[model samples]
Target: MITLGHAQAIIAGAIAHAQNAALKPLGIVVLDAGGQLLAFARQDGASFGRFAIAQAKAHGALAMGDDTAVLAERAKGNPVFFGSLVGVFDGGLALSPGGVLVRNGDGAIIGAVGASGDTGPNDADAVRAGIAAAGFATGAAA
Candidate 1:
């Protein structure tokens, strides 16, 4: 099992990287296998709303066992189902492209991480960098 400490370190590293790069502040979240929040952080300048968005994105990825990018693509093709999901979650679920699934060495999905407040691609890159910095694999869903 991946500890919350590890998750926090990853998120912190990601945020530090973003800050060093001069990107906008971000809110990041990590969710366990059961879609429970393990750790979260809202950078000093990040928008308050980004906290929820980041969590929702991570939850969606953890729940679906796929990257949010893939889910966004599927949602584009199945608007009705995807639309229903938003309604079901009361607008908390996001099918955006910034969440990624985290898996263990045995190929079991351990959790997921998400970032918000940057562009979708940048958010994804930050999360990827964090995961890699933690000695984890990336593009697991791809």
Candidate 2:
């Protein structure tokens, strides 16, 4: 099991990166492999709506066993399936391009992280930095 401490560290690192970059405040979420929440943070001035969007992004990555970017692309080809999921999840099924899966040394996916309130590329960059800071490998999802 990935420790909560690691999750917290990843979130903190992401927050620091965002601060240093002067990016807009963000809502970040980390979820274990089982798609359970491990850690979360909402920077001051972040949108309240982003709280759920961040979790959805992370959960979508964990559920798909890949990064949200790939899932977003897949959604483009199968909008009905992906769109239905949003309804089923009651808006917690974000297929954005800002979520990343975290893998352990043995290449086992341990969790996923998601960020919102910045552009998709910037959000992805933050997640990558956080995953790297946590000492985990970031696998390409696409």
Best by lDDT: 2
State the number of backbone clashes in model 2.
Answer: 0
TM-score of 2: 0.92
Off by over 4 Å in 1: none
The collision pairs in model 1 are none
Per-residue CA lDDT of model 2 for 1-142, tens digit only, reads 5689999989888888898999898899988888889888999999898778889888888877888888889999999999998888777668887789999888889899999999877888888888888888888532
* Model 2, C-alpha of 36: deviation from truth (Å): 1.2
lDDT for each candidate structure: 0.82, 0.86
- In model 2, the Cα lDDT at residue 104 comes to 86
Error (Å) of candidate 2 at residue 39 is 1.1
* lDDT (10s digit) by residue, model 1, range 1-142: 6588879877977887788777788999988888888898888989999988898888888777788888999998999998898788776678887898887776678888899988877888888788777767756633
> What's the residue-level lDDT of 81 in candidate 2?
95
Candidate 1, after superposition: displacement of residue 69 in Å?
A: 0.9
